[model samples]
Target chain A: MPSIDVCYSPELLHLYELEGKAVVAVDILRATSTMVTAFAHGATDIIPVMQLEECRAYAEQGCLTAAERNGIKAEGFDLGNSPFAYMNGQVKDRTVAITTTNGTRAIRMSEAAQEIIVGAFLNLEAVAQHLRELQLDVLVVCAGWKGKFNLEDTLYAGALAERLQGEFEFENDATLASLYLYHAAKDDMVTFLRQSSHVRRLENLEIHKDIEFCLQHDTYNVLPVWKRDRLVNLKEFESLGV
Target chain B: MPSIDVCYSPELLHLYELEGKAVVAVDILRATSTMVTAFAHGATDIIPVMQLEECRAYAEQGCLTAAERNGIKAEGFDLGNSPFAYMNGQVKDRTVAITTTNGTRAIRMSEAAQEIIVGAFLNLEAVAQHLRELQLDVLVVCAGWKGKFNLEDTLYAGALAERLQGEFEFENDATLASLYLYHAAKDDMVTFLRQSSHVRRLENLEIHKDIEFCLQHDTYNVLPVWKRDRLVNLKEFESLGV
Candidate 1:
């Protein structure tokens, strides 16, 4: 039986050896939720780049570009940090090259793992099933806001932990702490997050609807995998029995 | 209106500036709990040192000494990491120099704060009362196991947050998470900690009773304050109405 641990933020990423462990990257406030939405639509591939120049390089090759910083859209990018942007026809059958303030940085930092899967409340069931199938030690890496721990990512990590409780061994205090939070707040997530620092910060920007939509559970079944610098739906490889 | 925050480990001490804040350091598994016991028995002072040599220097000057590492007593130290050692007559009216793997190190690392007070569930009310009187932003710094977060320290931090919830504003997610944990484990602490990684590791060494003693609430009312390179009971200053 593989074990499960949650690295509370990207700053703690160096403490774990990720050579053979499957890593699930979570940024529930928007980034992973947005990427999962992109895959749920008909987008073929989404390349997550660490720098604006790297995202710009893919944009030069005709990929739609999106970038976010400080909760606002990057001045020159086509899409900001909103998941609703992907629901429109702009991403259907197209590719998106994107960078975000937190999530893409965590994805790039996590490329050393055996596999990197984007996870969110949107695809909770699918991601839990995928982990059960792999049966390898899973490390949930939270892309905290600027190397600091945030509530939403930790809450999402706990929700996955609650779903996979008996199937895997919990590794640290953080794992149990997260499980406790998930159970305490499972009843009404919106109310649970009402006073969180990140939610209030986002609400200040008038994106209340985005926060509500992003918090919905199992709204999509797509699990985006980081492979060779791009994210694709993990189901594409399921037929191969991987 | 002093705000309160909980740092689950020393690794987060850098995230906040400590210049004008009052810090309450906690190492509930043994160090802070033991210190509270030392004060409860009328010990005059405890000087927390980082290195064995620093403790040795204090011992050479006629102060009693205690040191712990890897769940065992240092080879030649006068006492190990048990809180009961202080409840006995060994610490009464004597100054003791001590070193531990986690707690003492956190004390040394937090010297920059305007004030440093050691806290544990044993002296829960005294510490909370003292913080209410200080009227400065309080940072509950958990001396986690070697720069990583631990269960007992976080639980103690949460218990403090629970006691001080409405009187102060919470600084971050870690605070709310700790409060959640304290509430979850409030009913039966020993059973709540049975499966935790550190508790299990400590149990392997057959020091189960120490865990139980450390979790007891209101066992004492001594608040140990760090002053002039030594920790003296805060009650020593109560005569001045502080």
Candidate 2:
């Protein structure tokens, strides 16, 4: 049986060998949630850049740019790290280049993975189904806040692990811990996460709506997968049967 | 109020600011447990060295040496990483020089902390009471398996956090997550930890007794603290009124 492991922070990514395994980069506070929302709203592809300048440069190539730093929209970027900004035709038929505090860095660091996909509570089932179809060893890499463990991303990893249960062998203590945390928070994640430092930080910024929106289960049926240079909707790609 | 945080692995210790805080280094699957037991058995002090050679060098100074690598006692060492090895007059009134794969390294890495103390289920309340008395910010450093997250140590951290609740603020998600894990495992830690990777590794070596012994709560009324170059029992030192 293929093994499932959870790496609580991207800074610890080097500990795991990523060769031939599927890596799911999760930043549920908003980056991956926003990316999944963008694809559901007709975004063509997403280029995850590490710097604000890199994201802004994509605007020259006719790609919609999203940049966030410390949970706020960066100066001169078209969008911040909010899923609401990706809806209602703002991202229709367009490509997106994005940069955020934690999420984009996780995707950039997972360059050695066999396949890298974005994961969020918004598209949890979609990511799980794709992994099941791929049938490979899976590693859920949480984009923890500032290279430290965060509650939201870990709960998302647990939710994913719970979905992939029985099919994947959780061989590490981190995965077991995550599954426990997921079960503890699954019934009322918003209330359970109210004590989280990151949640408090976001609440101080008055992005409570984003927190509630991002925590909703299976709101989007999209799997944004890494292909060559950018993330394209894998579900749509597979539907074309190419 | 001071804060309580959990650093799940020593490899991520750099992310935390340990300057004025009390760091409780916990390795529940036996290193810290052994140290606490040694102090309880009348050991004068413990010098935790990084290398086996360093620990072995202490033997020439008439100090007892204990070393373990990959869960086995190193050759020629007077003791392995087992609490039972310290009982029955083995460590009485003697200084111990110890090295371990995870625990000793965690103590060494936390050099920046204002005070470093050994924590295990064996000395849970003793360590917690010492922290309450010290009135300092606490960082529970789990000496996880090879710098990766492990279950038993995090559960120990959660147990400590639960005891210190209402006095210390849990400002990080790691602490919150650990508290949840502790609540999940508090009823029957032995059964809950059967799936832990390190527990399984030790069980393979037939150290099932060590696992059960290390998981017992408040077995020792001792707190081994770092003072100058070695760990001495803080409860005894405080009784001297020094």
Candidate 3:
């Protein structure tokens, strides 16, 4: 069986040897959710930029730009790191370049993995189904708040583990513990996550609605993959066998 | 009321200003548990050095040294970072310098805090009693796996939050989530942590027994504190009235 491991926070990325593993990048608070929503709304490809300047420079190339710092929309960007913004209109065939605090950094780091898949509670079933089909050793990379582990990401990792139980073997106790947390909180995710550190920080910015929207399961079937210095759909990579 | 904040992972340390908070560093995996055992066995003080070289230099000062890497004891150190090595006869009345991957890094980073307390499952009650005697805002620093969030530390943080309820205000959702996890696992801590990532990592090294020993509550009452580049007893700082 393929070994399933949990990177409880992005900082643990260095400790993992992602030689042949398929990495699932999870930033449940917003980034992955926004990307999934963007893909769902028919955006041709969502380019994840790690730095704001890079995103701005990419936008200068005529792509729609989205940027955020500390939860608020940046003044010059086309949108913020909000899923609601991604779903605001039909974006079919449009190209978007986006930047945020944590998620983009995770996508950038997983460039060396054999394959990378963006994960979020918003598309839980699709992610689970994809993992089951991939049948490769999996690594759930939680994009914690600025290089640290946060609750929502790890909980989602546990939920994924629970869903993929028979298909993979648990590589560590952290993964199992997360599975337990997911079981206990899956019934009431909203209440369970209401007081989380990320939620509290975002709430200080008056963005509780983003948390609610991010936790909605299977809202999008689109799977975002990192390819050619950008995050594109899996279909785009299939042609290249990446 | 004092603000009781639960930092789910050591990487989240940056989010905290630590300007006027008492940080309780909990690493249930081994560091805090071993620290408690060190004190209980009559060790004079533990200098929590982040580098292995520092521990070796401390040995040159005529103090015994202990080093742990990836949950295993370093070959040349006097002891490994295991609670079993810190029992009644092994560490009594001796000064020791220690280094580990995660726990020591947290102690060093938290030196700027108004106060830093080493917390573990072994000394949960003592920590609670100490909290009751004080009135400073408490920041529960979960020394996650290599600066990431791990379930055990958060669970311990939550347990402390539940014990300190009504005396302090919950600062975020991590605190509430940790508290819930602690309650959920209260009946079977060993079983709860058996499948944990850290535990599984240790088990791979044939140290699974350490995990069970580390999770026992109220096994000791000695609280470790950071003082003058070392983690000594909190009483040492009492003279400074801090």
Candidate 4:
């Protein structure tokens, strides 16, 4: 069986040996959620940039720019971190260059992996099924807030670990730990994660609904794969060399 | 009210503005566990070093060295990471330099904080009480395995968040999410975390019992604080400007 290692934060990515593994990057709080939602709603691809200017520069390629900070949309950007904005129908067939406080950084950091797939609660099922089918060693990269572990990412990792358990062997303790947390809290995942520091911070912003919505599992089955400096549907890779 | 931020991994430490917060470094796996047990058994002080060689260097200070890897006692070390080892009267009145994979790294990373308290299930109450006595903002830093997020650390963060709900304001949604997780898992925290990646990794090494022991709450009231490249007993910090 293929083995999987779970990296709970972006900083831990370097500690992980991902030379040949398929890296499943997760940012459940909003980035991955937004990406999956965007794809599911018909966006063509997302060019993930670590810097705000890089995202702005993508505009030269006719790409839409989405930026966010502290839960609010960044001014002068075409989109925000909110998933609803990605679903506004203006995203269909459009290419988006995106930058956020945490998720994009994680995606950029995992570039060395043999393959990288965007994972979120919305697209979890797709990610799991894809991993099981590929039968490659997997690494679940959680884009914690600014390189720190946050609940949404770990829970997503736990959920994936739980789903992928029978088909894969967990290579590290983090993989098993996350699966255990999810198994124990799956029944009331949203309630269980409500007190997490990141969620509490968002609550202060009155975005509790986003927290509740992001926790929903397997809501969409879109698989966004990193390719050509962007995350597009896996089909984009199949056309190249996935 | 003081605010509590549960950082699931040390990597997320940068996201927090530590300018004036009292950071609680939680490593439930064994570092905090051993520290608390060491103090409970009357150890004069516990020094936490991120590197094994640092532990050896501290040994030059006329202290014992307790090093652990893969949950096993390392060769040439006076002690392993087991809480029982520290509580078995081997650590009383002795100065020890301890090294472990996760907790020690967490302490080192938290050196940037205004204050850093070593926390675990065993010392949750003491940590909470200690934090309550101090009016500064608080950040719960989870020393996850190798810079990754682990369920054990986040659960401890959640547990502490639940305990301090009335006394602190949550700085973010992550805190609220962790508190929710703690509440959901409170009935059987040990069992809830049994499947965590960290515990499972340890279980493969036949140390599931350690996981159970690490989750026991209020087993001791010893608070460990970071100082001069080590996490020593809080009392040791009376002269360090704490």
The window of 10 residues in a row where model 3 chain B has the poorest summed lDDT is B233-242
Candidates ranked, most accurate by DockQ first: 2, 1, 3, 4
| Residue A97 lDDT (model 4) | 87
Candidate 1 vs candidate 2, DockQ winner:
2
Give each model's whole-structure lDDT.
0.85, 0.90, 0.79, 0.78
Residues A1-242, model 4: lDDT tens digits: 89888887777677888878899988888988888888877789898887788778888889999998877888889998888776657888899888998988888898888899999887777899999888889998888776665767877888888888778887565776566567767888776676566776777888777777777777776889988677879733211100
Model 1 regions more than 4 Å off: A236-242, B236-242
Model 3, C-alpha of A216: deviation from truth (Å): 2.2
Interface RMSD of each: 1.7, 0.8, 3.3, 4.4
| Candidate 3 local Cα displacement, residue B61, angstroms | 4.8
The candidate scoring highest on TM-score is 2
Q: By DockQ, who's the top model here?
A: 2
Instruction: Tell me the tens digit of each residue's lDDT in model 2 across B114-208.
Output: 99999998888888888989999999999999889999999998999999999999978999999999999999999999998889989999999
**What is the CAPRI rating of model 1's predicted complex?**
medium
Worst 10 residues of 2 chain A by lDDT: A233-242
Give the 10-residue window scoring lowest on summed lDDT in candidate 1 chain A: A233-242
- Candidate 1 positional error at A53, Å: 4.4
* Regions of candidate 3 where Cα sits further than 4 Å from its true position: A51-53, A56-60, A200-211, A235-242, B6-15, B50-91, B100-102, B146-149, B201-210, B234-242
lDDT of 4 at B30: 84
DockQ, each predicted model: 0.57, 0.82, 0.41, 0.37
